[model samples]
Target: MNNIVEAKGLVKSYGDFKALNDIDLTIPSGAISGLIGPNGAGKTTALKSLIGLCDVEGELQVAGRDPRTSRHKLMEDVCFIADVGM
Candidate 1:
């Protein structure tokens, strides 16, 4: 099975704070998955990085395209819905 989403050695930082540290993930096609964690656990950061909403280090690919370089094209195939606050 090929991965629909793949990340290796993923890292995301904000100034002096590290939101994500060395995250490695893979989601096979047609598989269901979810991310669960307490607040500030880097869950949001990871999602943001996957979709190219934030800058990230290491290798990341979604649907066979690099998120960092093909963000707009990637968006055509993927959709992201962040939490809404009132």
Candidate 2:
């Protein structure tokens, strides 16, 4: 399957704290993928980058578009649901 999400050498830092570094990942189209890690593993950061809520360094793509550049266009396709009711 073609990759729907791709990130290479992703790096994010706040002040002196590095939240992510040199991370590479790929998610193919029509595939089910899961992210598992302990807290502060940058899972939320990565997702936030995908949705363009946060600015990050390195290459990041969603549906073949840059979330940073095409945030307004891509945001419509993303849904955020609260888990409080679950």
Candidate with the greatest lDDT versus the true structure:
1
lDDT string, candidate 2, 29-80, tens digits = 8888777899888877777888888899999989878999999988777654
Q: List clashing residue pairs in candidate 2.
A: none
Weakest 10 consecutive residues, lDDT, candidate 2? 77-86
lDDT of 1 by residue, 1-86 (tens): 99999999998888888898999999999999999999999998898888888889999999999988999999999978778631
For residue 83, model 1's alpha carbon misses the true position, in angstroms, by 2.3
Query: Number of backbone collisions per candidate, in order?
Result: 0, 0
- How far does residue 84 in candidate 1 sit from its true spot (Å)? 2.1
Show the colliding residue pairs in model 1: none
List where candidate 1 sits over 4 angstroms from the true fold: none
Residue 19 in model 2: lDDT: 81
